[model samples]
Target: MSNQHAKPPITTTNAGAPASSDEYSLTVGPGGPNLLQDTYLNEKLAHFVRERIPDRVYHVKGGGAFGYFEVTADVSQWTKAAFLNNVGKRTPLFLRFSIVAADEGAPDTDRDVRGVAIKFYTEEGNYDIVGNNTPIFFVRDPMKFPDFIHSQLRLPDTGMRSNNMQWDFWSLTPESAHQVTYLMGDRGTPRTWRHMNGYASSTYMWVNAAGERFWVKYHFKAEQGVQNFNDAEAKAMFVEDLDYHRRDLWNAIARKDYPAWRLEMQIMPFEDAANYRFNPFDLTKVWPHKDYPLIPIGRMVLDRNPDNFFAQVTQVAFEVSNFVPGIGPSPDRMVLGRLFAYGDSARYRNGPNYAQLPINRPINEVHNYNRDGPMRFHHSGNQPVYAPNSYGGPRADPQRYGDPSWFVEAAEIMRTANVAHKDDNDFIQPGTLYREVMSPTDRDHLVSNIVGHMSQGVESFIQERAVKSYWSPVDADLGARVAKGLGLTITA
Candidate 1:
């Protein structure tokens, strides 16, 4: 009115074209039924019906936050990762704590492994540590992953989870014994997401500038302190409040009580791995601290909660394949499988343009020829979409960096069992853990806990197999006690 052109009233429409009317649909007459030719009405109804997307196959229930990872100690000598190049260098990060093997609406307090995934928005790219609370996994090979997950999930016919199915899979796969021991112990059910630790179960490779490589594992020790609930307590919590873990995490952050974890690593010399006591690369096993001690690396603190749960938490994707220059994958079969599975799952769930989402997008500028897909928010703009075009499209930068190489003299690529090491036997560490690591009270609770859950399954053979496995690892007396508690005869 005052020399400025008056703006028109806003009108909603499909795509971008303005619509004159949205409340009423085009009809045969003014007061009659709507017609199919009503493009606006049809578009509105169509979109509203298909708004929801496919849910995640696992780690469905989760809590997330925004935070920073600061390099508190000197770890640059291990690798040339820019995030750990300097002390006090803070990198923006988003962390999601989840329960593995649960549905989207499953109870948060269920007795299952917790997933502690961190996405570090580094200058180079978004590096993800898609890991779990246990340092060891059920299977060392990827071919067994689907079967393992199927056992944990609901039965195909009855739509109910079966303890028989779970124990049968565990008993058959001897590699699962280490993780099964931990699962049957107190640590299986964490008290809360804030009080749990995380581990990169798969061994990774860290390469230095001198082309020297070392096998490493990442451990996140909870600064809030590790706490866990027994089987009964976890069940009661589920009935009382299914969202107890989620609420606890949200309330803690709301009260300005942030959570933190001290990042540590178990480093093994390259040559030492070749002659190690056990397979350093086995996902089903852990490297003893005596052989490879924990070295302090950095600190990760979750200071802020996500503003929107759906945008930041639900849509967040973590892939094991997201590695930086100095960080690379090892020959661990489980890890190699996940590198493909995680990324493939995201693409199927969120389309090929999933990486363009704000939560998944890296802090660094993405320069690629990949163009045109569903939900492609960003356009290359004036930049050419195809490579080798004389129009000055972005080209591959070879000088940037490359992964470290090692001499491999092995012949044939056929799958085979690991060459047994001096301490390759399964029962030794689990035995040591039960006898030495646990106190008298802890052992009593561990036995009681196993008996409680094992009673749910009707298969006596499965129970016997479980008891034998537990006993073989710890002590015959402990096994006998568990058998007696389960109302079964303990065979000497």
Candidate 2:
């Protein structure tokens, strides 16, 4: 083909072999049968056939961007992390926002939980702050997580999600009260991903260079201000545009109306966990800001949009287990459970070499003995695959690169309650949120949302049980109001 505007080279196959006309397939004769001898056509069809990969079981639909995290304040006294060692330092990061408990096909405007997964490619390593829009989650224990998520999904026989199953599970599990309140309130239908704050609300451990350990929590407060839509408004908006949230994010970054968040934290001494008013590691609970006030450290800004949406947003993996120096896991059951689950799920969905993918590859050098798996792109040249080799293999440094270690009593192995959690009741935080935290108008909206969900296709007995077991525990007045609105009798 002759062209005035000269390109670098002619079209080629995936293997760099010069390609011919891709319009037609090779055949035995004109319109007889396709020939396997056409390697170019075969390669194209095979690649296209296996193009799609398995999506996340949760947080399947998402929007992502590349950006930078700037250290605005210093916290070197608390953490030995190199990224947080100095003020005015910047770290490259990729952030992904997604809707929970839904497939990729679902609408972005669905009234569901949103996830904020940010991967910080710091010099130390890739640290993923996998969090959610809400400060707390529904289930405290990892054992209840799968069952809780199952209720929100399709039923075995009918294959349709039932409100009865969802409410029934929540009513039975009292620990879910706090998150349920957040979910049914106006916050559930956030205006857009840019408007909701992100949280490392789960407790984590931070150890300084001096071998001092402290419990910490992170909050990314949205600079754009938190906003939400009422039920009426959300329904109307969904009808007009189902991908409203995704479009809002892509357009916002494209127009340079960049969104930003302040990264703040709550720090408590390691020994303080024993006598804290609440279980500090509970995922269903929040550390009161009054008791543990926020301390600003850094800020995150998303200024660039991804050129390839599928590569950056869909394939980018953020595991809960990815931790770097100066940071380590806690006794939080949910976090512990996810440490295994997140990595395992990613391997299955993205293949074993998923980490080697460009979107997931760390900018810093990655040297490991892990070798010989499917799709392995990098094999260190002529290096011993095992450790303890005389050929200059990388080795762990206990003194230089060690993580902080804390002692847990031998008797703490079982599920039995200790003195700290003996009287740890689930109703405390949700009640405080209802009675003292929310405004009068906010309470009204919360009640309205609860009634609307409970009133849908659920049996009268389950409805009554849900109100009495869940809502009544939060506030008797709220339970009574919900009963009245649902036209149900309030017995006992």
Candidate 3:
């Protein structure tokens, strides 16, 4: 409604000066040549040349819209986060959905994990929850992240994605079994961003007002319920519309059919990590619901679409380290590494002033001393820019907003497993999923899909490794079915 009657003024340059004509670029004597003397023409050309910043390293193709997150339940017992302090309190938010392994022009129907990057503009500051649609990740260690992504991307020489390469990396890395099984199953190709749930696969620590700490994971359950396309249906939709998810989201919001999701949290006491059967900080595994149950907290509704795709959606940044007073990072290795990596990558791709951008900026008045980067918008007035001054300047107050404290045991500096981890192996959870969770139809689909994807294009050697090493470890039935489907012999 704000833009309902906005034909008030003509377009202008970045400077407030009104433009004389947008139809024609200034030229010397009617199309002789572009005139360098024409400031507007030169400015336009220069800005156009540098319109785009570097795309994201993983979540390159993304789209999002403006929305609000409203607390619907009391959660003060587990978290002291102000955003979740009161029921019926509304916080402005933006949720950007993207594919993990995709080019700018890649189809929406590709079988890839979708990013669910959310930013909450609370009174405290900007808090970001960077996650994927799946509950777990391909690998737990950040050391393997770059190499894993390289395998998913195009070959160095031909610049074409090789199935062999992807399977090879995943096969050798046994920890990827749970997430790999989920990805190769029906859940991989979601019908739309609206249909799939978003999960914080990494562990986080939240402290209450009473100073009690709890390890937590976030789950945003889609109100529309889970929906997915079969491999054939996904391929057909890709051929029909490359921008299927993008158009679906925009049109749905425009038609007043706003999409919504319920926010849920799984909380575990700080001391419970010591007794858990598996590594509580492992990125490739999920906390079982039977142990840590989901508590309904809030609801998120996307009610409006971004007016400019490049401005709002493309330029937006999400950092794993973006936390408020109560929420903080955990001992998760992947999470620890991303705390620095995401912010650094965002700065390199979007410039040092990316946080100052409209979509990424916090609603709270930024009171830090950080100033004078390229395209710096606001310069603090009269106040002393540096600390240790006689003049009034914001000083650090550890009691008011300092990060929460957690006990850490001293260990030797070396590559090691999770603390108190029981039998550090990968396939147990995936085997549980195959045996106890999925139904007969789901199991059939999983086997057929793996065989179809692997045998169709992957090299014989790669396929053999994938079947015997990855699939078999997860479940013998799954491996045998895949081998039979692929017309390959299964041996002891």
Query: What are the lDDT scores of the predictions, listed in order?
Result: 0.85, 0.87, 0.88
* Lowest lDDT block of 10, candidate 1: 1-10
Per-model RMSD to reference:
4.2, 2.3, 2.1
lDDT tens string, model 2, 1-492? 358697757778998989987598888889799988999998999999988888787788888888999999878789898888889999999999999987777777777899999999989789999999999999877888889889988899998979999988888888889999999988888999999999976889998888799999999999999999887788888778888998998899999999999999999999998878778888888888888899988999999989888888988988888998899888887888899898888799888888998888888888889987889978899987898899888888988878666787676357743237654788888888999988998899999988988888888888888778888888898889998989999778
Give the TM-score ranking, best first: 2, 3, 1
362-452: candidate 3 lDDT, tens digit per residue: 9988887888888888889788888867887888888878787677779788886554677457999899888998888788878878887
- Which pairs of residues collide in model 1? none
TM-score of 1: 0.92
Best by TM-score: 2
Give each model's clash number. Answer: 0, 0, 0
Model 2 misplaced stretches (Cα beyond 4 Å): 1-9, 417-419
**Candidate 3 structure, TM-score to reference:** 0.95
Using all chains and alpha carbons, the TM-scores for the candidates as numbered come to 0.92, 0.96, 0.95
Point out the worst 10-residue segment of candidate 3 by lDDT: 416-425
